[model samples]
Target chain A: MEIIKIVSLGIVATVIIVLLKEIRPEFPMFISLLTGFAIFTMILGELSYVIETLSTLARRVNIEFAYFSTILKIIGMAYIVEFGAQISRDAGQESIAMKIELGGKVLIMVLAIPILLALMELILKILS
Target chain B: MGVVSFINSWLRDIVVLFILISIAELIMPKGNLKKYIRLVIGLLIIFTIINPFAKLFRFDFSLDKVVFNYAKPETFNSWELEEIYHNQERQIEKIYLKKIVEDLQSLIENETEYELVDGDISILKDEDNYGQIDYLVLYIREKTRNNSQGRISIEKIEPIEINRNLEKDFTEYNNDESIKALISDKYGIEKNRINIKIYKKGIGEINE
Candidate 1:
């Protein structure tokens, strides 16, 4: 998350779009799309690293594979949401952008629903 | 390899999650799905290229693995093994053994209540010369089980073995009562499920 990298990416994006806009208006959208993808990938790079580390850590600790894997998936969902939101913002559709963001967040929580339920079930069984 | 496969699995699972969500959204003449498809594409790029770079900067980018070797009674029975894995959900993976150990990997894979994905179990069968095993090898090719948080009832029935590394410990610690204890202890196996076989190294029968 270095400031320099982020700024450079933004500059590259702007330049790409600017160049693209001259050739064709629709080209700006495609250039922006590619630019947005590049930026999103840059951000996602962090998450993928995180996931890889988590898996390695899991192996190192000799813990259950499923447990950490679930955590990763939850984290992955959050990242996808954030990535979508940023790209959508770049696309300049605030309303649709929010929807993209909102969908990612809610879906992640939903993916986690089963785990949450299992935890509750365990607590109830323990108390009872 | 096990670690990479694990992350890839979760990423793949999320990708599938994206697809399902997109389908459920089912918006007429869906444009948003196309948009999400791009995000999915971005996710692949992130995992392949971006993620490893971050680890380069961190000093203590070390993650610890939980060891099944720590579980007591020399040889691990199923219940204790599962308990260990379930207890340390955030820390280690029991199935790392599953990746290498043939007995356990095949047990869970050959049949289980959970869904199977992205894991392969390769077992090299050993037919003993004097009705005794030469060498048995089980290689885990893939694993995507998420026992702690997922409802994937991965009934991983890893076959039991005396780890060669622990051979000395087994001889030193194995007294008559201990041997009996190994027999009597709960195996996390269902009732009437075990077939008893006694072998003293080669082909000689145990006379006791």
Candidate 2:
């Protein structure tokens, strides 16, 4: 399955990074960075499948597109931010990684509030 | 597309989400505020999982206005972006037109002492190659100096006098063999409409 292939690729990348870290210290960062980017892009390809299925399901369930897209954006933001911060940390930029995480948290917070409010409003309506 | 399989797949995701939410609620400290927050969050998750469509039941809530207000800013930003590009395009066109006017000013200076008022040059092209100048519309001010009291000095130019250049120079302009042939051979515009008239230098015109 795709999971196995991805896991194998991750293992291979880690092994290569470790081997290169002892030999050419500079090369390891670049290797790891590129591997992370490649993996992120590969995961993005898989995300398209998930998105397609979700959109089809949303359509089948007759859900409003706005909500579905908001959910998708939130999900995408989480994954992309997590991936970016991990890559930054792997490159030994702890400060930069922290800032990325901070920005991602702010963005996720901003994006999520509206949905939360809408849901609260819905619950209130039901209670009333 | 089958309803049964579709429900099965979505059900798995819902179960996972429910478990995660449940764990989150369990970890929270037991209190009135916690209870309300958990209930609200849990209900939201459950509603989203069961049928996100259920939120549409509330008549006051518009998905577009309430839940997806983020989408509006993108469109607004895009319009601002487009306006920036349009402003750039207008700036470029103004610069190009200024250059063309400078070229025309020099071209007219070679033959006559007429300063151009306003003009436009249109070009028509074919698929194969660069085409010819289709038509040139030029409004010019005729520079006329008079010898008053045996002294060659600038005369007060009248706007009324220069309009007669159509009768005087218009025939001479059209009768010019080289330009007439060039216009007929290249531009393919009708003969009579090509009325190239020169107006006398009026007030506020540059005098040479």
Candidate 3:
């Protein structure tokens, strides 16, 4: 039922975007961006449920919570960056989209540094 | 058996890690970033696999130690504690001595016609006279006017000559007495403890 609603919303938005493309080309970008946001919000509720279940599973297994949380953060960052980049691309700002992607990559690298350092230290310890 | 339980736990950890990574990849947005995330996940998997073997080999392999060294305080045995204390104390003393020498060098330069080239101080470490300057040795030379002129090229190399008349030159630069008195008066160090030596190579000699 939720998928049907999302599909119907997409179809209606597509029609409006197509109608506005000739008269006011800029309006089409806004319409598409609005539709994207609507679909994102709709799926976000389901995504939270999945994340909660994954975290509980991680807890049940007694896995290190740090790695689990870090992975979650990276996934969240990726999704947010993807959303921003796509929006920029839709607005025909290719450079802005690329910059957004670069920023996201740098942030992800910052988050991953600790894990990388730990791995390096481990390797060194083994070697020595 | 303990071995069965150990293997069971290890297998469970690896499987859980694999499943978690798979879920991450599944949820991850597809783009150029996917490969990087995959690389990090691969590293995590490698770390998890190698971690047990590292432990088996009795290596001190803990991610917490690497990541949280600042956040966490580690307990040390008495010997290590003493070593750390002595190291820190020595560092403080070294900085203190350096500052004192710099101050004395500037003082000598400002108050006298001599330029201090190098100096060292020995602090009393005994219980009664702790931290008192026990010995101070300063290598000094006469300041020349050419100090303002940047770099001067040496036109010719002078041949070395053995001069046996050293005491005359040494006693002639007894302007060091006034310098010793000034330091002793200002720093409260004993005049006998302060030793000033005239350097043979003055700034004038190098500039010429």
Candidate 4:
């Protein structure tokens, strides 16, 4: 199964990382980042399928494509941001990780602005 | 019943939206950013719930327009981006031309003793002089005061064939120059580009 392969790969990467920590401490960070990226790339196909299903469900339910698209963007942004932050954290750069997370928050806020404006306009229209 | 069907659809939409949000939450990375994401999720839920009600109330707001404006062009090629930019440029130019016409109409009616009936304006579409007024044609009629309150005097209807040139020259000399100068001062358009045609009250033909 794919899970078996993923698990084996993770175990092999962990063992290598543990061994490399003593000989070359800086090299372990690159190895860990490579492992994370490898896993992410492997699951990318499955992630697309999930997104496809979600969009189809949204279409079937007559949910606005705009909202669905916005949500999709937010999810994609979150995933990338999280991946970057984790890599930074793994490299022992806590400050860089925090900054990456802060940037992600700002980007997410930008994506949410349109939805917030839409809701605010709806509320004002209803009240008036 | 219609109400039953509406409620059914609305409930289904809510369920789907909830499922989608759940999926998003499941996939989301756990970190210090979780709370911010949760706040956005809360807003999404509220918006989805109230959206149908907004439609029912016939509110003029459209979320699609707002979202589309904010959306990034992830899938578009350079050609498609250029096409969209051109479309927007054309739309803005059309709107600008319309506003200029409206302003000119109001300016004539308020500042002069003529009522604007119809008009056409052309703008330069070249790269350098884009949006500049190329020519303006205004069909105006002299405003006449109401004779109902005062004594109505019977006047002879002038022959269209004979009096046309004289009437045209009179109007062109008196009103056209003043109007052209006014427009030139306001809009910076050349006086020769402004073509004003005056029509008398009873004349069915245009005196250019």
CAPRI tier for the interface of model 4: acceptable
* Model 3, span A76-128: residue lDDT tens: 88888988998899889999999999999988887677778888888888877
| Candidate 3 docking quality: incorrect, acceptable, medium or high | incorrect
Chain A superposition TM-score, candidate 1: 0.65
Better of 2 and 3 by TM-score: 3
- Report the poorest 10 consecutive residues by lDDT, candidate 3 chain B: B157-166
Which sequence of candidate numbers ranks them by DockQ, best first? 4, 3, 2, 1
In model 1, the runs with Cα more than 4 Å from the true position are: A1-9, A16-28, A39-49, A62-64, B1-208
lDDT of 2 by residue, A1-128 (tens): 87887788889988998898888888877777777777767777766776686667656543456555555555555556666777778778988888887786676566556667766666666566
Residue A51, candidate 1: Cα error in Å is: 2.5
Please identify model 2 stretches exceeding 4 Å from their true place. A1-8, A123-128, B1-60, B69-72, B75-208
Worst 10 residues of 3 chain A by lDDT: A62-71
TM-scores of all predicted structures: 0.33, 0.44, 0.57, 0.62
Displacement of residue A45 (Cα, Å) in model 2 is 3.3
Clashing pairs in 2: none
Residue pairs with backbone atoms closer than 3 Å in model 3 (clashes): none
TM-score of 4: 0.62
lDDT of 1 at B154: 60
Instruction: Report, to 2 decimal places, the DockQ of model 2.
Output: 0.07
| Positional deviation of residue B61's Cα in model 3 after best superposition, in angstroms | 4.0
lDDT of 4 by residue, B74-187 (tens): 432579779989999989976786677678778988998776655667889899998889988776666544464587766443322211233343244344788888999998
Task: Rate residue B89 of model 1 by lDDT.
Answer: 53
lDDT for every model?
Answer: 0.44, 0.57, 0.78, 0.77
Name every residue pair that clashes in candidate 4. Answer: none
lDDT per residue as tens, model 1, B1-208: 9669757765655555445334323421223334443443343333333223333343222121212222133333679668877788523333433443344334535543211121222222344422222233222222344464557676565444423332322211112232223323422332232222222231222221
What are the per-residue Cα lDDT tens digits for candidate 3 across B59-107?
A: 8766755654422233224686589789999999878887887788789
lDDT of 3: 0.78
